[model samples]
Target chain A: MTADLHTLTGAYALDALSPEEAREFARHLTECDVCTHEVAELRETAARLALAVAEVPPAALRARVMAAIPEVRQLPPPGRVADVVPLRGRAWRQRLPYLALAACLVGAAVAGGVAVNAEHDVDRQRTQAEQQASDLASLMAAPDAAYHTTAVHGGGNATVVSSVSQARTAFVYRDLPKLAGSHVYELWYSRKGSMVPAGLVDSGRPSGTAVLAGAASGADGVGLTVEPHGGSKQPTTSPLMLVSIAG
Target chain B: MRAAAREEQPGAPRPGALETLLDRVSRGDRDAFESVYTAVAGSVLGLVRRVLRDPAQSEEVTQEVLIEVWRSAARFDPGQGSAMAWIMMLAHRRAVDRVRSAQASADREHKAAVRDHSPAFDEVSEQVERRLEREQVRRCLGQLTELQRESVTLAYYRGFTYRETADLLGAALGTVKTRLRDGLIRLRDCLGVSV
Candidate 1:
């Protein structure tokens, strides 16, 4: 299957994939070093083809484009760890609750899923907490990050902060109905006609913020479902809430 | 000042001018943006025109693409690709998106019929001033197998999906996919571009 996806680099670089396929391949590119390199080279080749067909545009385009530049706002550079430092006191304080909740989720997952070694779980939990904090910081500070909020069917609201350029997404759940038993909330990246498991949240947690697993770039939407512990290979229950990322 | 230095040189832009100009544009330098525009507008417009075929829409898209470069200049990571590749990718994707959106509403058969009659590659736009590049690209394209050449051109220049390209050429979908990859590998080698 991956080899088949590997061949998609040429078509992908040429802009020949269907939108859904393009998104899937883009997610693939984020993980596959070989595809990433090939796509870049092929894109360079495509750019050369553009040079072949280059034509002088109507001269008026220059005036219009220049006139339009002033009204447009340029995006800020990607967030650096140092750039995020200034926001640590206020912005970081504001995000403390979410961070704490995310840490709890990591703690719970490690405790419940890896009960074999208590010492190992503690170490893993600490590492994950640190990772999530940094990931959340950079994601929140991303220049292109956008927030999408949708009402959960059983309860309150779910907001997704997605940074496509960063290929990461973070989720904040508010007032979600408490799950019972071993059921957990599973995050999914809704592609064309299928749902891909993105991550799992500890069951019975009513509200929290956690970064969803996997590449979120080009996902059509994000969906949440109640699933058995450890999560399902595919969504076993219909999504309780579906948030379109197109916005 | 750098733009002035560039103005003294005739012909194609100096290597790395676009990248340098983009860095300036990201810092809100209008003069650098102009230099960037002057360097890339023709290629952006020409690519859009080839894909859209409608001159007015092509111009609008070219404007959008350039403005996008200005707005997202900070997003351009030189580590990922060259400035020209970044700009052209933006232009090509915008053109392909518009055409595909339009196709979603229009008659598919009519669209295919129109595409069928269009030349495999239109005469290199007479307005293209880069004669050496035009000839070099033409020569490299000429070296591909007929199937490989058609697959690449139909998808890249004509904005057809691989499945669509396969259907048009009466080839299997898998064959078209391989040909597109193989064809690009050949072009990449011929052009001497390394990732």
Candidate 2:
């Protein structure tokens, strides 16, 4: 029997076509705007039909679904390449000078004793930053990574990428207002009800990643708060941003 | 039909509201997900229950569909359709998958029984419930001829392909396809769904 692709529009919209027929219709659809519009309308009708059957879900389902959200991971926003690449490139550019200065300090260690310790600190931090960048890259690529993007209280936005299975997380901040004085952005992990200190975040750059302690398995959510230069044992103020770790 | 009785009072939540919630959900907003769940879980579960005919399995599929919505919210395009439609489409797909997989397992257990019981009785009750639930949809569905309604319902609610639906109804494959297409066109028009 000769099959008219147009006749398959309803079956295609309902996803009732056989695999081969479905593929054939998909190919046909690209060349057939009329069929495409027809299919869209059919789908809308089907959706409305589906809506007619709305019965109240079990009461327990609400809590179950809500609890599951934190555990599920979200897809990264579009233009992920654009978001990640430039920041890494800019960081590399900024780090090159510091690396050069560190080398110069090593060379002039005999001239100034103080330069050696400062150079060591810089090297340590640079190594840490590199590790954090690598972690951020891996988290971004992880198929199971759950992401949450939230606006900071004062200004800017933060994207938190976490994997409960990996027990790791990375926070990316953009356009955060530079804090003056001894204040710093500190991270916290809230589990059940209590909050635990995670780490300090630097707000000096236009964009940067903050690597928090890898204990996502134990945490239900992540929060950021402004604290003294060194993080407080407990959050001394309200969170600047609170992101639920569930997807 | 129960659905026909309720047609005078359209009860579906505004599609625009769902669209806005979906946009927020795309931004990784957990609160929006909760709100969206509250808005659509019943409908999603109801659809799945109709297709699967097993409350336990339907619940599992519903959870999976909702989690998928959370994970793939970024892919939702408001330009294409309303969020409710996008969500319902997901529900239908997942439910169909469950139905097909269950059929596959039943075939493995008893291949002959699978053919003998193409569309189970429980499935029919679920379909009746579905029809009774939405008045406008029922009214629209009622517009289709008997052959058209059977072909469409077997293929859609029972998760049968056109060929399977044809086999179940003892009709030609081409005939089933034509009936489904015609039925859907009538339903779309009756429901006043715009292309």
Candidate 3:
């Protein structure tokens, strides 16, 4: 029943078309019930993509894009030609003596194209810039982030914060010797008689464990606890340290 | 509402770069246009950053893009495209013009590195333009057939027409069209768009 719905979906997402082609399809879109319905779905996909890279272009470039928009938007509309819009049926024919009507039409067409094109151009650049910035941001947060953070822990110990989320939190901890035999180190975050088990971290010498990230903006401090091997959901022991979060 | 917003939006061309700012400057408002200039300079500067290796040259290009933007602020048309597109096109055209005018060395180098150039290192700010903001394009791009995806990317983002795309991919002309059309269709479907 669905005749290659996927391909049409892709086409609509990118707006990759000659103007004429776009117009033809636009007409079909109005008439076809399936297409109208499908458009809504595909648009969501497009929006997600558009938002993928919301990185702000450099400050200076924002002005450039804005500045260029007027002129770049000078593109002629979908199918407008160099025909003048009549000012009035009576005022039009009478004033046609100086060829002003034709001249205005030509001027308007050229001006219009330039106007539209500028707008399109700046829009394109800004979008590309933002998209690129977002890409870079994600890359920085990825496991293979180019940024290296040697988070300084208590006792002058430093551990590499390998991963960070957009919320600006990183898994942080430092060197601890491997436990011998059946013993294992557990990780827990305690706050107000309630300890949230972040995870069961290894006792691999110099291993890093995820912490309860930085601190609550106005909170007093954070505490970490250790428990028996494989760790329980609740804290069973006192914290190794009560790190103070800066206000 | 549109008129009020339009007053804040700059896009006409006048005499000097300062001339464009004159409208804002007339009411003892130099600071306002300066704010505008500073806010939207990223695309212009970024273009210079990518195209010109020499810091001085890049600065010069950036200046030119900005100055031109100021000059042409009066003619902006809000109906056709958003303000962002207008500025980017100015920057892009200036950049491309510079690339073309620089003879061949820089052009050859950039073209060589286009694919290798990762769209990274641009996270300096938080107000990105909308057109380039689509992350789904890249992610969803994975869902497409290799040929279809490449066909669209190379043609649109990479600046190739069907003919050029055909030559580069070593496919037939018709194949390129079908790839573009069908790929777009699939993308639209995935995106759920009408236009």
Most TM-score-accurate candidate: 1
10 residues in a row with least lDDT, candidate 3 chain A: A106-115
Candidate 1 local Cα displacement, residue B173, angstroms:
0.8
C-alpha RMSD values across all candidates: 24.4, 19.4, 23.3
Clashing pairs in 1: none
Which DockQ values do the candidates obtain, in the order shown?
0.21, 0.18, 0.10
Residue range B62-179, candidate 1, lDDT tens digits: 9999999999988877668777899999999988888888653253334433422222221112122455567778999999999999999999887889999999999999999999
lDDT of 2 by residue, A90-144 (tens): 3323533343333233322222111236567678878887776566545443324
Once model 3 is optimally superposed onto the true structure by TM-score, how far is the C-alpha of residue A119 displaced, in angstroms? 51
lDDT of each: 0.70, 0.66, 0.42
lDDT string, candidate 3, B1-195, tens digits: 112232323332211122223333233233334434533454445444454434445545766766665565545443323334445545544544454454643554545434232233222233233333244456567778999888876644333445667789999866776787666667766654432
The TM-score measured for candidate 1 stands at 0.55
Interface RMSD of each: 17.9, 15.4, 15.2
Quote the chain B TM-score of every prediction.
0.80, 0.76, 0.53
**Which one wins by TM-score: 2 or 3?**
2
TM-score per model over all chains: 0.55, 0.53, 0.35
Interface RMSD (Å) of candidate 1: 17.9
